[model samples]
Target: MAQDTARQAPPTAPATPARALLPLILPALVVGVGASLLLLLVNGVAERLQDLLWTNLPDALGVGRYSVLWMLVMLTATGVLVGLVVWKVPGHAGPDPATLSLHAVPLPPVVLPGLLLATVLMLAGGPSLGPENPIIVVNVGLALWLGHRLVPGLPGGVWGMLAESATIGALFGTPVAAALVISEALAGRPLKGALWDNVFAPLVAAAAGALTTALVAHPALDLGLPPLGRPDWGDLLAALVIAPVAGLVGLCAVYAFPYVHGGFRRLGHPMLALPAGGLVLGLLAALGGHLTLFKGLAEAAELARNPQGNSAGRLAVLAVVKVAALLVAASSGFRGGRIFPSVFIGVALGLCAHACVPAVDPALGVAAGVLGLLLAITRQAWVSLFTAAVIVASPTVLAVLCIASLPTWLLVTGRPQMQLREDGSPVR
Candidate 1:
């Protein structure tokens, strides 16, 4: 009877297999550190080259560093050089960048060098895009290729997740951003274990990456804006209005993306297309001044440092010109990301709001504008929220941002995203 009772009892489900997770820890740490180093290396090289191009060479020639003629020459030349690399380099720089999102298929090893070269050139050449997309692609490709060779038993997805999370952590100088981004991505897929169990390795990687970056560079996102005190009804009102307006402004760029990309494609070759795009960017630089150039990180900080430095008209022009430049850079054959430039646009718009309406807190305006534009441009809810909050670095604004996201999300939810399909149509 005891034996019969034992047989009738349901077999215990296999234990959660917590021991299986132990093997991933070392690899995750290695990938995390490696990801941070690569990001630093790429940015470091680009910064040196940028100094040479913008400062040293211009100084030697006795030309104004950011004069109209110099901006025109430098940007046009940058396009030509980048176009040549794309035209002649093997793998054609790993496909047109417009079709790529943050999470893309791992590229072959052969394609990485050219892609890196193109990305570096774009960074130094004053394109209105950031290092996020291509750098992520490079890190993911390296991680997968090396991980498979080193540990033949693990799934390719594991390496991809590690590299992605690590790179994101490194980019933002905090593991929380990586966690948020990965959590959002994982929410759509089926899982075998508890969510935290599944996230264990990636979180380790992200933390390691964030630590490495912080130790070396001490990166900080806070703009040192005035403190936002406890949230009031007025602050909430400002967030709601500014965020949606920024969303609609960003939507204008989203709607225009396909047409701009299509126009560049009709040029028939990178050689013609990139130079033409550069010329257009030069025109924009002349109108918006030098502050609107580059990936927009330092430029945005500069804008934030003295929000009242520019008149309302000037701020509006800066915002509009930046949006146009970002579109041109992404649409042309340039290899870069959109997030940094979007941040700049949001900052400019936020300042513009404050300039128009003094009742709105500048910090609130900036955070809300960032939230709305990032929502429209990247379509990553958590990332948008995290980025918006970090810029202000105030707990009080979080409540306002959360409430502001509701209306902004509604405006952007059903619309087309900023990315393109393989066929050159906007991804809806």
Candidate 2:
């Protein structure tokens, strides 16, 4: 710890000679490579594990109906893992909100391991969360500790640049909107480097991160890139309405979720809570049937590919079932992320919207609605914009989604809202 502090301690000189800078640069590269390797290894192993757990576990359990009882088992275990993480990890599971934005970097290194473990469990188990959150947790966490210990007094701006670049780099396969997100977050703060340096660091880091992710994650990593095309007036107006609706729903989620979930947390025992929530999910599945489990992208995609076969309002029920299950999983403290659930919400929203205007395409509607929610709630314009554009193959669909997203942003921003968390405390 003392050695780390000494490394981070700043010298009186404002600018270190290029020669002096090399030492810091070399170590940073080493750390970057090491972190990248960890990411790859973790991702590859997790993918295989996920498939094994998600696919083979059910059969092994003799749950002949393909019921997601296995998911329940996985979630329950991860729940315990996350509970331990929150207990031992200093910042508590993944990135804090401030750290989530650019203003903050990784948590101090002393507690980074638990966060990494919690993140791994989240993926291996099946929370709706994504690689992005955990990736940031590990990367930024390492960067912050290294910058503090090894590169101290090197200039806060330089550390910030490194952390930010690392984050941007990790999102390589996806339309991470790194440049755009970074630009938006750093709108006010002034970094130490010149314009070129500022841009170059994140670009390189993001490229490296993406490459590393691809090597590890393989076929799973897709940026959802869209072809460039102009959308019409209708698309723009649709976007305006869509964005606000998504925001409203997101706010509702951010709000009502706690009240709804607090009921379960009150149970106070993982043993009781997991079984109880599992029972509830099982019941909902029996009632809602088929829709009560994970959005199961492959399942949703299959349904989309064969829309005509779905009669009996199956899509609608599936949407509601997902909403219920996701809320339960999160509210009950089951370990997982929200993006997977949110994707279902977006898809459901699209299914409904498609019915409204026969003129607007179904695929287009799905793309637009999903992006709308992403924009409204996440405040991540680039991420949502890219997500909306990429999921489908058609250029026309992409154009519509992009145009529609503009209005959705306006709608979400216009609302007055409060966030709801399971702990009964208001989310700041």
Candidate 3:
């Protein structure tokens, strides 16, 4: 007992670099591989289930894929199903998802099954959220539990950092995205040494996770937008105007999210609140059509592929309905992340801008639009910039986006976040 206590006692100074390196590397690799495999399983099952729900059953029923009646019925049923899990399942699926951020304290191991089940239902049933939060929580919990047993001396928050980094890396299909996100998150905090010293292990884990997903599952974050040839003054002007417009659109939803969340929580039971949210989401889906379904990645691709096919008015409706769907799913008893849907919302806004003007460069408009929405929703500059730029897949507009994001940041900086306060109060 004395030896164990002494091992945990505060050191006179930080460990030497040589000693720190191996300790960081080995655990990161283990956690990274574990996280990667878990995410793969979650995504795989969800995809198969989605195919069954939206494809096989509908075909068997002779119903059209986007039929309003079918979607309405299926979504509400999903709500009942997931609500049962949330209410009756052990661990109650951890905590209210609306109160969670991209990262949070590790949940207990017992929470894993119910959380994953609820998440799969949300995804397969066509909620506007993504697998990010649920999957991250799973990874964090597993990593913490494993790390404690295997590497008792690792610093606090190290496993969480690794889990978050690995998840981001897997989701976006790149270690660099995780690095940028972590850098933005860690920017203002007190530091003990060079940033890279702390970041190195997580980066290693992120790379492993990113590479594993790419090699095994075929990474899917790309938007496949047309390339921008060169920068022009017209593009610059459009970015300055359009990015903030997207930010404004996102801010509107951000403001509404907490209120909606609080209202649902007042019901005081997942069984009641989730079905109600599902019904409203179904109604919104009926209004917005099938394009509003899912996490928005595939639909965003569809939108980008044929911008000319959708009228400007249609694009605007898509953005609004998606924002509404996102809020409803998140505030209800659904378990998921906000980033993927936010990307879809940003794409809709950008496409709307381009459709309305028919003058702004398409690629530039899409990139700027994403930049603004990500900035407003995440309040993380590096993440917003990287996400926007990567989707556009061009270097020409990065400078303009950087400049455009500055003003948008001001608009979102002090504003209320989308997550609810723990006391069940609205953010505002």
Q: Pick the candidate with the highest lDDT.
A: 1
Candidate no. 2 TM-score: 0.74
Model 2, runs deviating above 4 Å: 1-36, 68-74, 77-105, 172-176, 191-196, 219-243, 261-304, 307-312, 334-336, 355-358, 393-402, 414-428
For model 1, residues 106-184, the per-residue Cα lDDT tens digits are 8999889998998999999898999999999999999999999999899999999999999999999999999998899
The candidate, 2 or 3, that scores higher on TM-score is 3
Clashes of each: 0, 17, 0
Clashes of 3: 0
lDDT of 2 by residue, 1-428 (tens): 99999999965324434564454555444544555666676666667766776677766767644355544455565566666675566656543221243233346666667666666665555544445555655666667666678768766555555555555455435314566666666667665544444455555555555566566655342223232245567666665565566556666665566665677767875556545665665556555555445534544465556434454266667666666666666566443445546666666666666555544555655676668666544666776776666565556665566566666666666443223432366545
**Residue 93, candidate 3: alpha-carbon lDDT:** 87
**Residue 313 displacement in candidate 1 (angstroms):** 1.1
Per-prediction TM-score: 0.96, 0.74, 0.94
Q: How accurate locally, in lDDT, is each candidate? A: 0.92, 0.57, 0.87
